[model samples]
Target: MKTLAIIDYGMGNLHSVSKAVELVAPDTRVLVTSDPAQIREADRVILPGVGAIRDCMAEILRLGVDDLVREVSADRPLLGICVGMQALMSRSEENGWVDCINLFPSEVRFFGNHLKEGDVRLKVPHMGWNEVYQTTDHPVWHNIPDGDRFYFVHSYYAEAEGNPDIAGRTHYGIDIAAAVARDNIFAVQFHPEKSHRAGLQLLKNFVQWTGA
Candidate 1:
């Protein structure tokens, strides 16, 4: 049986993410845990988190999940969600600059208090559904179409800065890296569990992906 580990380091919507993965891939064994052994043994690893980047990184380091994530992501399929995604960057502008795992050569930045689009003021968190435009071909985009709306509830987003590894982009007063992929890792700034159809399809694709 296929094993999928959802890393739980005192952050993230663990149960909901576990349920969503179970819903899409019922036959797979899902383990939501912080144990390094279990995470290392799983066929696939999912790094999920919510809340401030500072607290997220603190827990990740405190639980030794930082090195674990780096080790597992070296040659296994790994998915990061929300703050989990931001944690893959070099640093985040949130909480007055917190260092991340640096899996991707990018930085997390705030939406700004004066964010606006054509004379209309936008919110800080950028909460709600927004269209994600596919920038590169990837297995996770298999059944998902370009410009499909995904659920987002983040004030900070990854600034890929024209990185070739960027897989998806979305506009919310400014362009944001919605997804990033490289080698065996795929991370997203949106919550696929709350994204409905498109989200589920993405998870399904991730479950079946071989990281080729």
Candidate 2:
């Protein structure tokens, strides 16, 4: 059986993400664990998270999931979701300034206390559905259409203006890095588990992808 490990660093929505993965790929074994051995041995790895980058990074490092994620990402298909995606960056503007794993050379920036679109004021969290524009072609974008809406619940997003690794972009009050892809690593600022159809399709694509 193909094993897919979702790193449980005490920050992610582990149950929902594992269930969604199971729903998309029933044949694949999904493990929600912090065990380094299981993570390394799995065919695929998923890093899913919610909440602040500081707390997330603390638990990740404490559990040694940071190293395990990096190790697995080097060889197998690894998917990061929500704050999990933010954790892959070099730094986050949240909680003053916290350093991240730096898997991708980027920074997580806050949407700002006072954001606006034209005349209307926008919320900081940027909750609910928003369209994601595909910046580049990728296997993860398989059947997922460009300009499709995905569920977002974040106040901070990875900067994507000139980053070459960025695969997708979205807008609220600013340009948000919706997705980033490099070799075997694919990370998203949105939660696929809660994103409905298009999100499920993206997860399915990841399940079948060979990281090519």
Candidate 3:
């Protein structure tokens, strides 16, 4: 059985994510912990976060999860969600420019003050379901359609430095990197736990993936 660690750096919706993982894959051992040893022992790791980037970064560094993430993400099937996805980037424009794990060569930028679709204005947080257009095929996207809608609640989105790393894209006020993958890592700006069928399918796929 696979052991999946949900890294709890005191900043994520750990219970919801853990419950979602369990519901998707009952056989897999889901460990929600902040201990580095437990994280190292797990076959797969999930980096999940919510709230401000500054506080998230502060907690991550304080708990030494920043190093743990870098270490485990090197070879395991690492999944990042929401601000967790943003933290994987080199930097984030949130909270006046915060440095991240630099796992992916990208930067997180805010949605700006004025965002609109035609004449109608869109909310800053980009809350609710939005269609994610798959850009490339991957094990995580198996059984999921190309333009499936996923739940998203983020003000900032990742902007990859290059196009190759982009796995999916979505439009709010502009086209943004909704999902990114490279090697053993796959990160999404949306919350799979809160996204219903499509989201559950993704979590199921992640559990079965071998990181090949």
Task: Write one digit per residue (lDDT tens) for candidate 1, span 1-212.
Answer: 99999999988999889999999999999999888999999999999999989999999999989899999998789999999999999999999999999988888888899999999999887899999999988999998989999999999998756776789999888888999999999999999999999999999999999885
Error of 1 at 209 (Å): 0.6
TM-score of 1: 0.98
List per-prediction Cα lDDT, in the order shown. Answer: 0.93, 0.92, 0.92
Which digits, one per residue and each the tens of the lDDT, describe model 3 over residues 18-52? Answer: 99999999999999998889999999999999999
lDDT of 2 at 102: 89
Candidate 2 per-residue lDDT, tens place, 1-212, comes to 89999998889999999999999999999999888888899999999999989999999888878788888898899999999999999999999999899899999998988899998999878899999999888899999889998999999999889887899999887788999999899999998899999999999999999885
Off by over 4 Å in 1: none
State in Å the error of residue 131, model 3: 0.6
Full-model lDDT, candidate 3: 0.92
Window of ten residues with lowest summed lDDT in model 2: 63-72
Report residue 15 deviation for candidate 1 (angstroms): 1.2
